[model samples]
Target: MGSDRTPIFLCAALLLLLVVGLFIPNWLVFLFTISMAKGLVVLGLILLMRTGLVSFGQGLYYCLGGYIVGISGQHWGITDVALVFLLVVLAATLLSSILGLLLCRYREIFFAMLTMAFSMILYGILVKSEKLGSTDGFIIAQATLFGWQPEVEASGTWIFALAVIITLVALLVMHLYFRSPMGFGGEAIRENEIRVEYLGVSPRRLIYIKYVVAAVLAAFGGAITAVAAGHVDPEMAFWATSGEFVFIALLGGTLHVAAPLVGAFLIEIIRTIALDLAPYTWQMILGGSLLLIIFFLPKGLWSLLPKRREEEGL
Candidate 1:
């Protein structure tokens, strides 16, 4: 347990990474920017996994986030980064809230398949929509911060900075969430929903809450990705995209809040280097890498760290 000032201390320490980020190479910064975006999505998976729910259709919200930014700028000329992010939040919340009603009733493989089906439906719709550029997709407008457009050369840096800020805020919220009883309600559900119900908690309600939170986080990640890449496509909502998210989620593990980011960076670095070294067999490299991790670090890469006394008891 931390004191009231823990957030202050944690935020200061996390924000210091921004200073280090300023010194990294441009390519590295871009890599990290995208990694952090995907990491945000995986963070939501971590939350859901702890509750014994695996969503294979997370790309629905991720795509919504990107499309919100893209269509807003294209049709409505809304390109302010902050405003589009707010739109992403609202859209994700609204849609997920509706779907979650039915989704929350399912568990295990049924939940997974329903999620994937919904994602594929969006992918199909995007592929057929002519104005949205069909399968080729369309470019989003360059995002501005509060109407202050960054120079072309500095736009990447601006996006990276936004990524940093968003990552920190999301991390802080998750840190607090995991410490609350509702957070533990998830784990308790995972262990035994019957026991959780006996304690006067509604497991379905908890799952619904987790599902919505995960969707919002995934959408936010998509918005960042759209702004950084300046593109949005039907592929963003495809089932394969959701599978990749699941890959990163497993690669990172669900043991800790930061595990997803750590895993995302590792996976990205591996994929980048492997693609350079063996483009034809990059997938093999990822498969092999995951096998090795599963063999040696069954709990995930986080297990490599020395355990604290409190964790040892867990």
Candidate 2:
């Protein structure tokens, strides 16, 4: 029954958030929009983690998505936000498809390092490209939604609504994916790759599929973030940005689909406070907070919730 109602509950919560956005300050709405975008990236990380893999370079796709949106707008004169999003997804799919073929062959540290290397390579290329603004990056033009232009003051509300809707759809899709055969196969691979192979399921193939899906999600997040921020920078591809995704994934735990979104918002709020309180030592405070969570709630913040009685055969 709990499982059956999860979707309904998620939908209700998202709807409530959308309504609440209308009443919040524009700055808060913008913050929520960015957090939701980052949450999508963390969701992808969670998917990979379930398969016993961690990516240190998902920012590769994230930056790719943002840059493609910016370039499409500034260079190609494409202003439709929806079209830019579709293009970003296609670009991410094409790149990840080719990259996955090679990346799926490795596991553990090798996979992590290789992913980071590819992202850094992109970073270096961007830094050297003067036309792309080099290290400073470039500004993204204001985006139009389905031929409707929003005033600057009202854009945040529209973007927040879009983010909420997309996030809800993503959550539903991911939740379904988590229960499908392919998803179960990921858990199986994580537990015992040899056994999975003995059952005639190739773990490499599963990893490849998961990697591509993750890249797509990351790209979606980046595109939304680019739209929300009104700018794109090479820092989007930095290892530190990817690290934050991983941090949120771990902070939220892999047990629930909504956990990453919760973690992202909480972390963002905490970071804001930390920055305000201790600008030079914010990272230290954040690290300390993580350590406390790890020591007290090994499964993550989600573990604090009461376990479903059905899981205990109640």
Candidate 3:
């Protein structure tokens, strides 16, 4: 029981945070959920990077998920949250699979460039899409959780719960996947595709699978983000947005599951604070921080803690 108490304690702590957030009665909880949603996409990016693949087009799947849910619920009369979620997952998997097949053929810079191209193309289409609300975007009408009509006031809390749930499920899936044979093969391919090829494992297939998995995760994040943000736009598919995902991933370091989420929360908080305090130079401040982090600690904030722990150990 003592050994199994870690997860119990962690859950309790998170529940405490949620309860406290609910009581705050402002945008704190909403801000947290937004950070989590962004974290989810960044976490997917980190996974891809773990396999030595730097995808610059995660926004493609992200936008696809958001657009699908927004368009479906707004136009198709589907208001069930779970149904929309399922649809987003299915759509994202199919789209990512179709795209990954071709994109996985390239490696390194070429792979990044190809992914960026695809995402930019999607962005262009969305910008020109009059029916999809073009650059103005479309608002998601409201969503229902099962049979319960969650009040508009409780939207942020509900979204927080959803983001937390999705995060947990994704963590479990990824942990299991990373420990599985296919996951090991993918890592091996990342390290050295030639060696993996020599061992009878198909590098291309592994890369494709990894790419598709990442896309699905990114799409899931995007769909929930759309619901949380209450809107979807062409900007979701933009190259700059994709870069944001990668930035969070790098900021947190790809070593642990929680790193990207932590990075997401921290960066969002910093951005929020900076925007509030220094509206005129928020971009400069944020950019400066990122540059400092990259130059001083390439492994990200996670590395600092570990390094400190190591120094203490010595």
**Candidate with the larger TM-score of 2 and 3:** 2
Best by lDDT: 2
The residue-by-residue lDDT of candidate 1 on 1-314, one tens digit each, is 42445467557855776777788888888888889899999999889988988889999999999999999999899989888889999999999999999999999999999999999999999999999999999999888878798898888887988998998899889878986899988988999999999999999899999999999999999999998888999999998888988888888788777788889889999999999999899989988999898888777888787765544543
Report lDDT per candidate.
Answer: 0.88, 0.90, 0.82
Candidate 3 TM-score, true structure as reference: 0.91
Residue by residue across 1-314, what tens digits does model 3's lDDT show?
11223245445656676677767756878788877788778878877888888989999999998998899888998877899889988998888889888987888899999999999999999999899899999998787878677888878888888877787677667755765678667667777889989998888888888888888888888988898889999999999999999999989987666678789888898898999999999998888989998999898888876433322331
lDDT accuracy of residue 111 in candidate 1? 95
If ranked by lDDT, best first, what sequence of candidates would result?
2, 1, 3
Q: Candidate 2, residues 65-93: lDDT per residue as tens digits? A: 99999999999989798888899999999
Better of 1 and 2 by lDDT: 2
- Measured over all alpha carbons after superposition, the RMSD of each candidate to the real structure, in angstroms, is 1.7, 1.7, 3.3
Query: What TM-score goes with each of the models?
Result: 0.96, 0.96, 0.91
Colliding pairs, model 1: none
Model 2 accuracy (lDDT, Cα): 0.90
TM-score of 2: 0.96
